[model samples]
Target: MNESGNPSQPVNVNEYDASHIQVLEGLEAVRRRPGMYIGSTGERGLHQMVYEVVTHAVNEHLAGHADTIDVTITADGRIRVADNGRGLPVEVRESTGMSAVERQLTELSFAPKPRTGYWVFGGINGLGLCVVNALSSRLTVEVHRDSHRWTQEYEKGIPISAFTRHEESSGHGTAIAFMPDADIFETTRYSFATLSQRLQELAFLNGGLAISLTDERPERPVRHQHLDGLHAYVAHLNPYPSSLVHSPAIGFTSENEEQTIFVQVAMQWNTRPPGEFRSFANSTRTHEGGTHEHGFRTALTAIINDHARRQHLISPDDEDITAEAVQQGLTAVVSVKLAHPVFEGCTRTRLGNPEANTYIQETVREHLAVWLDHHPNEAAAIIRHILNTSI
Candidate 1:
């Protein structure tokens, strides 16, 4: 109590100063907040670590360096990804003063070249490899380039040894093997089904790009590859002839030079109930339909309605066909590649690029209109089916 009999103010035990704050260097920040980088520490995050590494290889393929990527899950729960791409550059980058290999492994802000129409690379945020390194118990990278093979090793994101050069090698590529840290992930073992499904999607999305996933845990290893691209994907989803109302799926590709956008669509009407409408932006699946999907729906509905009206299949006074009605008994795959894609969230399940809406709409409308005109009989059948449902 004070002499004045009033309550005394509490004393400031410690002054606020710079010393109170601590700084985390290297990949320590990633370990501290793993979710911010990989979304979760559960199975999704574990699988995401694998995806991050594979994405780098896929980017190399897109850059015209590689043609095939091989992903294998070893018996010991380690993941090894190898690509026949022009290996990672061994030269030191002036900005960071670290070799490309070292910077990619240790630095969080290190980024490759910006994506362009020539190559639709996926890892734009630059957190891929570093995040994988930070979350792995051990990581080893080998690059075969310039007639020599170079190697480096790291333990939980820290360099265990300096880069070493090996005997001359003829082939060129990059290989990364990593074991997820048991302390960071809920589970270290990976699901073969999940990995295969994702790898197949990547292969389908990038036509001519070969990706193989192999499981070595089983007595007889299982391998999966898809080469027919989206066409095969649509057929795989609806395999039975009884399920498909159309014999052959309608597929097309279109590109906009000005917007630097490329879109591919494969669709077929089925006898079974309406199937899924799968969509992707830059190889990432968008489960929640965004501008790209919206554009697709708009184009489908508009084209169908216009064709029906022209063929006198519907009364002139009838209301325009609803998007849902147009999509009934429809199975479709829509993939778009753009240089600057604005995804809705970190999960990247939705695309928000406004320009994509216009580009996709125009492309679908024009190409589909011509198809409908050329195949009058098939177009009439589809219109009739839709009209019957509308009634």
Candidate 2:
């Protein structure tokens, strides 16, 4: 009791019971904290939802279950992604007692790791589709499996109708259509250029994985596809004859069985200004240079400096080639695939695995050394370019 009050009301501990602690079910938690799943409610987040969906289809292609994926932006602002893969299972999952399609759409923590060596997936812990479902105003899924067609519809993460079965289908695949929620997003319009660039990169990263993007909102629908892989990517970056010092980019792949990691690199020295270095881990782009990038740079600089010294291109007293000097006018793609990746954060823009560094460094060093020995002219040209930059 307070001194100034005659009596004070006793607090009732029983009032703060389990009933007061509300527990969110299934996608409800995702809707409440959408940013946690997709990064933001802004334009970037809006695009991420589309990417999440596309990544799944691409993963199927990587796993050898599919070869083609089509991404279309409708005139009505709906995004449609279709793939020619074994459709999502329509039967009920024993653990959850919900149909596989329903659980995949609604469950937040339902992502299972893909089979080792079959896929280099980049869908961010398998929560991609569930987040897309929670943030969309309307979503429809069609699956052609077991020679039959199955369909389901959802609105804002909840089922609008029961799963329906149609007559037997000739083909097998999965298609998803969705409209972004106006209440959760600042804008629903998809950027054609952004989608094109990302899809092109995906095509290059996963060789022969055909992906087509179409925009029906414009006067003439736009479509883009890449089939020649990273070689084509390097050629695109250095289009003119004068742009490339070396006619063809040197490309190679190396693997470490113990760590279950694979590394692929494509490199060319051009006549342009500062060059570009694109790096990836498990087919996911790493914009920020991490351990793998660091290792690559280290090995590249060392190899060039060693070759220059042996060829008498540089004086013994001259300082070793700096990373900046070695990278000048160079265009390179460094891609690594690992069974389990340790990324800097959920964004996965950087790799944190220490073993990746050692793997990449050794691979680049050993392979580049032999290539320099075999191609004296190209090696000399690269050394001359680096020498000019150092001076």
Candidate 3:
């Protein structure tokens, strides 16, 4: 203050606070590099736009929602997703005292966490909503909860209107309808088969969960199986010409205060194809196969090798039972749980956690070994098949 020897503006405490927090508003960056958020500007990304919208509903389903999701590709080219679950937040902002819905639709980095962790993070990235809104020419979000329905409209993530309460009868859930921006994405159309495939998998993996996918664009609607859950999933995907000893799938699930894990093991001697297994944190597939998958793979390989050596099924000089050699025709699914999910990349969302590896490995190792001992014939057959395949 004395450096200038003038009435140096009395150093004020409030004025000394850190510089104004820098923030990129609206869909500014998303529009600049759409691929950075949605992965690519190709068909995959086009499909991703739909996924981004439907994931919210699927997430609600996981959280014990009202149940039922309706997806329709309107003739007018509007993709509509409706789900029975807690609706997106639309309360008043405590800071600006403005409607939360208005702010989220109009601003960047504005999203509500259903829970502390990304447990309900069905969105591709935290940018799921923003990305979709930014990529769409027009967007509308309707929320039905607490016996009241509210509506809001936006243009590319920027709210154009305030939330309006609608008095609708016999309605509860969230509906999102958006028209993709042709300028932002090359193709704005969606593939029903691809979408159906993903939905069918979710239905199969989640027992007692009913998911329906209908393509109104085509006169003949393609329907998928709604029952059988993971058990059916394994059977359907089981190897062809399998000499299964009839090893029923064993499903194990555990949840801590932070995470939830669901594991299903279906082992049979099949002559169809290579082994297949996947891990999931929430509904999003862990394409890379995280810790839980690692443990499952390791334990399975080790267990098979141990059984083979003890049964004298293979000569001591045989190979070390590589993952590929052992999983020639086996099928299993290992799903992990994480409190705060940190998905890899924006579009290719996969679970990233080290602890899941230990849990899955230990559980499968202890249980599968005992299962093998209990069912000698099945274990021996599998090990023999693996050894034979290796040879």
TM-score, candidate number 2: 0.91
After TM-score superposition, the amount by which residue 253's alpha carbon in candidate 1 deviates from its true location, in angstroms, is 0.8
Give lDDT tens digits, candidate 1, residues 188-233. 9899889888888888888788787778888335444566678878
Across residues 299-357, which tens digit of lDDT does each residue of candidate 3 receive? Answer: 88898788777777767987678778787877766555455566665554555666667
Candidate 2 lDDT tens digits, 1-391 = 4445546766567867988999987788878888887888998899988888887787777667888888999999999999998888899867866888888888877775674463455665777888899999999999999899999999998989888889999889899999999999989998988888888888888778878888889733544455667777777777777867776788888888674888888889987868777998887889886889999999999999898899888889988889898999999999988877888866768988888899999999999999999999989988888778767
**TM-score of model 3 (CA atoms):** 0.83
Question: Which candidate comes out best when scored by TM-score?
Answer: 1
- For TM-score, candidate 1 versus 3, the one ahead is 1
The ten-residue window of minimal lDDT in model 1 covers 115-124
Q: What lDDT does candidate 2 reach at residue 259?
A: 48
> Which parts of model 3 are misplaced by more than 4 Å?
1-24, 94-97, 116-120, 168-170, 220-227, 239-250, 256-267, 309-320, 345-351
User: How many backbone collisions does model 2 have?
Assistant: 0
Model 2 residue 28 distance off true place after TM-score fit, in angstroms: 1.3
Q: Candidate 2 — what's its lDDT? A: 0.84
